[model samples]
Target chain A: MSVDQFLQYLISGITQGSIYALVALGFTIIYAVTRVINFAQGEFVMLGGMLSFLLISSFGIPLIPSLILAVLFTAIIGAIIYLLAIRTAKKASVVSLIIITIGVSIFIRGFTREFLGVDSVRPPFFTGDESLTIFGALIRPQALWIIGTTIVVTIILHLFLSRTMMGNALKASAISTRAAAMVGIDSRVMALTAFVIAAVIGSIGGAVMAPLVLTSYNVGVMLGLKGFVSASIGGFKSPIISVIGGITIGVIESLAVGINWGPFTSSYKDAIAIVALLIILLIRSGRLALEERAD
Target chain B: MFGFVKNKWIYFLVGALLAVMVLIPFDWFMGKYNTLLIFIGLNTMVTVGLCLLMGYTGQVSLGQAAYYGIGAYISAILSKTYGVNPWLAMLIAAIVTGAFAYGIGYLIFRLKGNYLAMATLGLGLIIWILFRQLSEITGGPDGMGGIPYLSIGGFGFYTTFKRYYLVWFFCLALLLISQNIVRSRTGRALRAIHGSEDAAESIGINVAQFKVKIFALSAVFASIAGSLFVHHLRFVSPQPFGFLASVKLVVMAVIGGLASIWGAIFGAATTNILSDELLLGFGELDTIVYGLILMLVMIFMPQGLFVKLKEIIVQWRSKTTQKV
Candidate 1:
């Protein structure tokens, strides 16, 4: 409500939003290329966080090296998910594809449960746990890392997609696999690249958020759904739009908590975002239908 | 023979089914299986409705468990708190759920494919949140209890054996009704819609109305199942009726062959047994196993277990005849 409070919520919202954006970016890349909404995307995020925690806490590995390995491991798992599950169901219907991704998600979650146990884990912060006060609003250092990395990743992704040959090929395949194939672009290769990139980004999201929110086996579903909401709200048109959507969702959710209506506390946090998901989806699909009709 | 049954062979089949239905509850050996049978029966009601929606109408709903939860909560609240008769509560739950589903279906059916699925998934999660958050009404995470049993003419279906019969009788009636619908002109129209919505519209089929109707019908089935479930368990909980339950329901519908009414029974029964008996000791391994089953079935045999098994049996029969 007050400026300081507003700033505090804004900082927190943006921090959370960055994580969602990363996950949504994962969703966006895969959706663009393969037209499959990979439900296992969140599992990659979870694996990133949990793996980093395991490496750092238990193995006593340095933070930076552990983070790098965790990200790489998650990316590998992402590719494996694609190779094992998504690629195999190439000719399946949309419903089948959704189920397959969900299956992979469940498997990953189960595997994580077995490997990591059901308890939550936290990776050490990239920087020391110092809270920086910017204009009377305290921002956790990990929050800055989350926000900073998201921006950097978005900029890099934009440059890569626009500036590189491989990126263009991936984009081309996404726009139309048939045309891309005709032009000698390997759609399969593009798809595989998309999965790898998405996984990498999702892992980054997981690694950054682990310090803030404690990574656990079950967090994948909630995180994945949040990312999904962001992607849908973003209209899957651009990564920028998804980032905005994620921030909007975070801000709204934070403000909702700030308001503190009866039964609208932290417990109903997921519900608020889901309501936003439905509304945005309704509006987007309605407009999309209109666009189709006009065309 | 009645027009619905059509032939003497049909009458004989019906007579045999009736005999088995009667003998099951009365047999001493069947006593332990009664509760499991009751659960399967309840799942069948929900799965059958899901079959009509997903298989016949080609609309995906990942929120059937939410409807089921609504039904249970409604029955529990009305019968327990308001002191309404449980049967009347069940009927009310069905009507209210049908209306709710109809409203949501109309709004959401516009989105096709993955969007529809995601929307339904979100809806299920929201309802789940409500089930957990609305503690005053739903009893929060601990869930509501003391739900009364369904009865007829002052005879309470209190015992597990009695509940088993009551639930199965409802399930069988539902199956018969579903079969009748599938054979009717409405079924044909639904099939047409599934084949192609644009084509169905061109043929003067009210695709939207039919979809909404079927969605409502499926929700009603889930509602009835929820009512029966609450009464049987004499408890209502938010824990069981979550996204996983909805996914399991979809799994049943898919495994049973989506369009086959009888397949719903097989799918529900098999899934229940797998979760209760085989997978229970393994804990969350059930989720992974279910996921594997869903993927494997979708990949190798999209036609579903019933249809594929039937084909295999037919092929084996021909081989046996050749050997003879």
Candidate 2:
């Protein structure tokens, strides 16, 4: 590929990767705290996009307020999902937890489809729908928004995690709930905070990327799977690692499609990333098993 | 002879139930729902295998429909495109699916719990994609049709009634086999592993091998169900083998009380009847209902409907007897 084309793909990949990174960050936080995969994490993103779109287009609300409302609403839903579903299922096996999260995901999808209809919708862009030339490669304004939001979220999350007492308590509980409890940190509250944070991040991603990618009720299925793939790429242990992993997957996927050689067509883009994930998983299986057993 | 009959009341009950099952399709009122019954039987076949794997062996597979798809595609291609005998095609499909699962399980069973679920989910999606993308072989998303039905000699399972009996025959046979396996020494070892893999290893059980073998066995069951499904419908589509279908299978397994062999029938029948009959008019409400059922069941009664109901009935019986 030519340098311009390569840069174009790279830019597009990073833009897409930003969304995946946000979703992966959600997965990382929840998994870190609760040890549950929370298959419905992607639904938070869907809710954010759809809620903002509905508020702006259908309800005739302005963009900025609608985005704030959407994110807040999604965060509330995330809290409800934890308090009503996850917490109530006390002492559930891993298999049961997975099934329950899947149940929540299906419920969210079905509820959205019933109420909002299945047509894919896109909210208007934050600034305008104009492409800017960046070093011979064109980048959409919304793409920049997505990338910028990811960077800002990453930096803020890093700061919050390191420079805050509450964040330290959350991390402490994740390390060992018993130890954290002995030090007066309620693990349940930490888990709820993690869910809320995950929701906020996921919703921010959805609202920002909605203009670039259409939002729909069923979008969560693929988005959730891809986010999980991204998180798994980082062994689901660290948020920063998940961010890098997400970008790597996005770049590989975009480049694979851009190459347009043999089976690396656009149609097989999803498969390429998944195939990569499977390979990585296989390589890391021994370590993953040991780590899980240690838990 | 009368005393022997009284002494073997459980055997008499089994005989009566079997007779009722066989006669259901012949009855005028019940015969109308033969298609539903056939679907329930087919699902029960898959759920039973899943029950053995998840309920007994303590492994979760969220991608069972991949095996189901493999079986359907293999049998569909063989019988329709290649003009192979339908029975031979089914046997080949089951064997191939079992082998495929054996290979996957060997690699996949290394990861426990949630990771295993993710790997299987990914596998299922990849297989679904292949079914949609392999236009030359799988007929792509539009799917392949016109597969021949299974037959013995010249008699074919041409009607819903005939296929109903055929499906239940396989379903019940597998169910019995699963029940027998659950009662055997191998079942004990599986329970041991389920309780604690490390402990099972310390006790000299071949945990990995057993898990892989059972995984293959469950895949074969799903394959058989797929074979039966395609032959009955005379069509194969990629849609039914997607992630949703795998979740539905898990629902059936969970509803049936994962380890309870007999509960497979109850679970499959309840879910099929609910979706196909009772909740059809509600349209999208079925999804919400299913989601509710899954969550509520897992939360309130993870022992499953059958086992919980049995517990309640037993407790009631004891109370009544005490009062008497």
- Highest lDDT against the true fold, candidate: 2
Question: In model 2, which runs have C-alpha deviations exceeding 4 angstroms?
Answer: B1-9
Which candidate comes out best when scored by DockQ? 2
> Which lDDT tens digits does candidate 2 get at residues B277-296?
99887656667777887899
DockQ, 0 to 1 scale, candidate 2: 0.74
lDDT of 1 by residue, B241-267 (tens): 887788899889888987889999999
Task: Please provide the root mean square deviation of candidate 2 (C-alpha atoms, Å).
Answer: 1.9
The positional error of residue A237 in candidate 1, measured at the CA in angstroms, is 2.0
Error of 1 at B112 (Å): 1.1
lDDT of 1 by residue, A209-278 (tens): 9999899998888888889899887666688898887878888888887777875588988898988888
**Where does the lowest 10-residue lDDT sum fall in candidate 1 chain B?**
B1-10
DockQ of each: 0.69, 0.74
Q: Give per-candidate clash totals.
A: 0, 0
Q: Show pairs that collide, candidate 2.
A: none
